[model samples]
Target: MSINNDDITPSKDNEIREPMYGMSINENPKERNPNSSNKLLGVFYGIGMNVNTIIGSGIVTTPGIIWNLVKSPIVVLLLWFVGGIVSMAGSLSYVELGVIHKISGGETKYLQTAYPQPRIMMSYLFSFMHIFAIRPGIISAVLQSAAQYFWYTLKEHQYDDGIDINTNGWKLPFTPFWYVKLLAIAFLLIITAYHMFNTRWAIYINQTLAVIKLITYSIIAIAGIYRLFADWPTSRTNWQNSLNGNSDITAYSASILLITFSYDGWNSLNYSLDEFRKPEKKLIFSNSISVGIVILVYLLINIAFISVVPAEAILDNDKSSYETIAVVFFYKLFGQSPVTVRIFTALVVLSVIGTAATGIWSLFGVHLLSYSLEVIRYRNKGNLKKEKNDKELNEKSDRSSKIEYEVSLFFVGIFILAGLFILIFSFMVHVECPNYNPNCSLREKRIEQMSPMLISYGFLIIALLFYLFYYCLDTLKRQREAKIIRIADK
Candidate 1:
């Protein structure tokens, strides 16, 4: 078994580019830290990344959808609270597996490590689904919402219809069909370009946007609370009706899907565990803190939404949920001034853009994992030749810059194509929906367009359950193995 000397040596860049026991998404040239022992990030960074990734279009748009289905503010709140719990549970599970495997891939690493028979194929399938269906679907949905708001702001100003100044801000009397969609595609492309080329700038932009989003949310929450108590007519009947609407298992299930979507990224920080200073302790702490913070943020935001906007209004907001229920709530607070609406709409755009950026950034972690697994055959081979073969492959790979660039481009191309395909499909679906329902509202059409994405999440949830089950079995097996080793030694 000849070891690759180049593998052990630093490159011309004076940095080692080896994947740890796992590869992380943070392997870009500028971002790579050579010293493995150096821990750079703290709990706050983790929380910021997690929140940015989790609280996107779902929070802004899904509340109305949930209210439309669940019809109970209390149940919706409970479901969101429960979603946080589920997220925390998932985070804890990831921490356990991450500590042991210490891999860069998120769920892909979990599946690869936990499943018996070493379902490498399943991991590949997961990567395929993630790049094709899951990431693009959700991202397109988010971009669509942001674009809709952006367009809404423009159209309101352009049309200048006789909108009541006392009720709602100036709104477009009708949707701008191709223009809004082209704007959405442009939004997606800008985000993709930012991440694909200027990742450092993208990170800075992401962090700044996250801070702005939190502050905006705080302002919204405080204003809503003030209105609820100080100004808005206090109606116990309104509160009761919100909490006592008709409950159905199906409704709860659908609401749970969206709620969990809002809470989905809590475990994202675990993918970069190697970056943490004291990963064993810090990973768990950061994840727990982040999830707790998300729960608080989510609950407060929902509370604010319900307080300022009545439940009936939210349920009937089928037309403009694609924009934001909060826009209407803010309209009620700040009056019908176009400036207020534009500022609020612009904030929503920035917030969702941050989310899309974080999500795309986090996705590369799984891609890195998949790439690492693809290159390191010995990890799963369980044979004596594993190291020698991997070493040979590493040497060949190290010598060839062109091959690596080609591979990188190949993956990047795949992602871009998938994104474009989904974006086009979203617009096509929007254009064609009227054939089925002549009077389909924008929010309803948006949801209809998002159906494929919801289905993708459904598949992801099933995969998550599979991981949990296998993780338990893997844990027990390890425990049993330790027990046997101890007995034999004794």
Candidate 2:
């Protein structure tokens, strides 16, 4: 009465699953490994990763810039809310792609699978922009904000002089270029090493930092709310003043750009759908809840900031800079001592660095995949050589494998090179326009500030459009093939 294992019927435990990226599933149950640890992610992990990725320097530094543009605090809040809505829409689109493809590699895989017959030039182009410009640009931007806060704090404590936004156009002190660069490089290296050597500790650090960030922001919000309610007469005047300015289309566009960039990391979990246990349910909940939290916290932070520090102080045209708005707000709250201000800045910087550290590994891996097509071609050529020589492919395969390892190393070098270039680019932008200068190196400043906007919004728009176009094309092709099969069977 004993049954052979191979003869056992396919049941819930042994059912064959389809390939993640649309390649044929190996239907032979024997081919499946039972001990692999590639289980789906739980809800909390997915949400934590999403929130961590979404909350970066944007929330800290961009508020003043957003205020300067919109002028009206209510309009600014509305724009942030709209940005959250757009982010949710983008997330749902990505989730749909995940439900269908269920693979990693984000947009690259989506484009490749959707347009398999065409040259797939769009996919490569997307990867190229992401690797060379978008990813590096965003990282450099955040780190630029980090370096600003770092140098500002250092100068405050050591020199007893606040950061001068108009000293020879450099955000650094007298000998500040290399010093700031060194700090930024150190920040990058330290975070990188933390994740590399102490992965579990890094996770703990990220969660701890996230909690600290939440607590700090909540304190700021609560303090402002208490003040608003406690001093209604003064708060009323400030609110009325906050709404008296005019906003043009240019202002709206600028505000939208900054807000969207701040929300850029909202769709981070979409890149790693394979980790999700139930993306269908979890994806919607995670994206929606995380974005909602961000929007609420962002509004509260803005309100708190304006409550303590006047709107003009935030958008100060001369002397005080917008970059130091948070410092000023804290200063007004905590008096002239640099200790409280420095601590506040440090907390903000740590939150940003934690976000970058959480995602750097994935960013590096995506950058390495720039060589994917090259690696595939090299392998095919090696196979051809083995066939022509009638030699066993074991040696050829070994050589090909060695070549791949070398190629990977080469791309790692490229990643480092790109980072250096970006770091330099970031520093140059800071030097050119340290304090949101009206008349700086206009071109470099725009490239530095606007690149992220173009890439973030541009990528989302192009991706969604491509998804629709290719989804329709794919459906038609599949229907035609099915009709042919039905006719043949008849």
Candidate 3:
């Protein structure tokens, strides 16, 4: 129970300190570096993280399911707004806790403090680690998606000369697993380099991606709406009919849930609480604007998608919701030449890379934070090298010596562990599908295989355990402190 509770409290029969959590690290986390306040990316950096978290494969995948479930174009656009409100509320709640905690583990950190018990802790631990211990699957999905778009882009390039770009040309070297591993390594390397060398650069990249994503989504949405109006569908319904339309009650309930996930990233800025100049003001601004912007973009994008691709086709064919919709709309309108389809796909892919990179970066922070905690205990009171080193080195080297060791150990461990965790998560997630006909797109397979347990269980379990453990420790600390105060008054 020294000033910092980064680690647990000391185990003693009687100690005159607040019973804290965890133990043993020398480094001052707060003192890592003088944050270079970026004048250019002040607000936009948070926006980037927001967009990055939300716009992953979700955009490409979720919209199709939504299209299938809610066919009305008006409801398709409106659902995004509803999703935004719920997620934004969660973001606001986090901002309040984030200031109180002021650490990077985001909601996970708060849950640990608030819950902190055995059963609850274990469940959350299992799922949390399972999902993002490394993020191999997520990274792979992004890369695989990127490659698809890349292949299509190559087709566009080949079109000017009237040569059919052999889609199979790159297929041999780019096996699914191989491409995933490569993209995982590549994105990790890029993010690591940015964060380690300069965080400002990382934020800058996040912001730039956010801006681009916002603009592209807006344009696509506007374009879609205009096109639909130009040739209004024989079946057009305003908000009243769209909401109460024959769309099944169960379907709308599901759409409500799905759209919520689609706009899941409104609170991305909460994770970067420490890095913010004035997190309090920033959180309000960042979360508010981020949710608003995402909802707007998502609404428009879906409107565009449905306007082009009939709902029935989208429902029947789960593969390629956004892209297929785009192809139908753009090709029929722009002439189904190979070039135009390629161009549209290129934009979608380009837009999502920055989105994917941001997610990798955020998940990386989770490992880094948890690893830092682990390092503190791994060093065991920073006594490892102290046993071997001279009194001179130990004394003059200062309290931070232990911290340096922990930090070093943290990065090394996370890299290895993260990679392995990702592989396992990916495999488990893969199993959600029994037979993968090598012909089926991995994307569709993943959607089919996705387990809702992946998202909800971890948070639920962690919240419970985290509350219990911290409650006992906090209660004991308070009683002990009160006794000490009484003695002093005497």
- Best of the candidates, lDDT: 1
Evaluate model 1: give its TM-score: 0.68
Q: Write the per-residue lDDT of candidate 2 for residues 234-273, one digit (tens) a residue.
A: 7766567664456666566666666777887876775666
Instruction: In candidate 2, list every pair of residues with a backbone clash.
Output: 41-275, 41-277
Q: What is the lDDT of candidate 1?
A: 0.63
TM-score of each: 0.68, 0.68, 0.61
Model 2 lDDT-worst window of ten: 1-10
Predicted candidate 1 versus true structure: per-residue lDDT over 49-104, tens digit per residue: 77777778778878767766677668778888877766776666666555554445
Off by over 4 Å in 2: 1-39, 157-174, 243-247, 336-338, 364-490
Over 4 Å off, model 1: 1-39, 116-119, 157-175, 235-237, 243-247, 321-323, 378-490
TM-score of 2: 0.68
lDDT of 2 at 182: 69
* Backbone-clash count (model 2): 2
What is the Cα-based lDDT of residue 194 in candidate 1?
A: 82
- Models ranked on lDDT: 1, 2, 3
- Which candidate, 1 or 3, would have the higher TM-score against the true structure? 1
For the record, the alpha-carbon RMSD of candidate 3 to the native fold, in angstroms, is: 12.9
What does candidate 3's lDDT look like per residue over 1-490, in tens digits? 1123422322122322121223223434344333434432346667656766777556655676665567665667667665665666565565566555545556556666665554236434643553443254455556555655554465442111232122223344544424445654565576557767877687687677666766666667777778778867532433223322245665666666556545555556655555665554556666667777776777667766666555444543324434334445555556647776767666766666776667666665466555554444334432334333234333433542232111133433543453354334443432112243445465654555454445544555665566577658857976887799799999
